[model samples]
Target: MAFNTCVSVIRSASHKAQMIHNQDVQAVSTDVINADELWSFVKKSKSTVNRKS
Candidate 1:
């Protein structure tokens, strides 16, 4: 029972992370006009991203 519970929790967390990632992809695609725009956005924001946080 303990193993099953751990598996269930892990699956749930994975699904949630996937959903958030999909949302981020959709948001970026909609906001970005083209490849250049996306690249520029990332380049400009690269310094602001927290690596381990």
Candidate 2:
């Protein structure tokens, strides 16, 4: 059915993505990196601030 085809496509894409991330990316060394900046960049946003008092 159409649903099964869609599921198969999604799974395939996910598998490919995982392979690339795991294999294509290399480990970094001999360089300085700021943890806070890396976390913020990966998260794609600044820390949340509560509005309620």
Candidate 3:
């Protein structure tokens, strides 16, 4: 009765928390990849400029 209701509520909250955590992890990974790509592009352009000069 009341106990089962409490258990269900707790399970629901836990599931929501897990979902939010997964989303955060995904966002961080995407940011890291973007940063790496930007860094590589900057390096390449710098090298090309140096070669021309």
Candidate 4:
């Protein structure tokens, strides 16, 4: 039960953080983008990601 609670809290925080990040990203225009860094930040290889592909 404790583990599930912790996961829920972390997930909530992650969503909030992602939302803020998305807004920031949209507000700026950059010529160079690093896909690998973004993927690493979101844990692309792990199951925590909503979309694996």
Candidate 5:
């Protein structure tokens, strides 16, 4: 019975860790995409302003 309880606890902890890791991966990907998009917009705007001047 003790062994079974230990196994159950380990499984639960592992599952929680996996979920947290997945969430972190998603957040990082979203941040990277946002940064890339912002950079592109800034570059385009700078070029446009330079042309006008």
Candidate 6:
């Protein structure tokens, strides 16, 4: 039961990461057509990388 719980936890975390990655990609696409949105994404991406580091 504990092992199953761990596996589920990992899967949930992975799913969340994937969702965030997808949103980022979408934001990039949106940015291409919109300069304002692009700047917003750039700022957010820099913050995310900083937080990770």
lDDT of 4 by residue, 22-49 (tens): 9998899889877988788668557555
Which number leads on lDDT? 6
Q: Which runs in model 6 stand beyond 4 Å of their true positions?
A: 29-53
Model 3 vs. true fold: TM: 0.48
lDDT of 3 by residue, 1-53 (tens): 69999999999999999999999987763433447888999999999999999
Over 8-31, each residue of candidate 1 has an lDDT whose tens digit, in order, gives 999999999999999887776354
Q: Higher TM-score: candidate 5 or 6?
A: 5
Considering every candidate listed, which one attains the maximal TM-score?
A: 4
User: lDDT (0-100) at residue 7 of candidate 6?
Assistant: 100
Weakest 10 consecutive residues of candidate 4 by summed lDDT: 44-53
Candidate 2 lDDT by residue in tens digits, 1-53: 69999999999999999998887556535466669977877565443333331
Candidate 2 worst ten-residue window by lDDT: 44-53
Give the winner by lDDT: 2 or 6. 6
Candidate 2 local Cα displacement, residue 12, angstroms: 0.5
What's the TM for model 1? 0.49
- The alpha-carbon lDDT assigned to residue 16 of candidate 1 equals 100
Task: Give the runs in model 3 whose Cα sits over 4 Å from its true position.
Answer: 29-53
Lowest-scoring 10 consecutive residues by lDDT in candidate 3?
26-35
* Cα-lDDT of candidate 2: 0.74
Quantify all predictions' global Cα lDDT against the true fold. Answer: 0.83, 0.74, 0.89, 0.85, 0.89, 0.90
How many clashes would you count in candidate 6?
0
Q: Return the TM-score for each candidate structure.
A: 0.49, 0.46, 0.48, 0.56, 0.50, 0.47
Those runs of model 5 whose alpha carbons end farther than 4 Å from true positions after fitting are 30-53
In angstroms, how far off is 6's CA in candidate 6?
Answer: 0.6
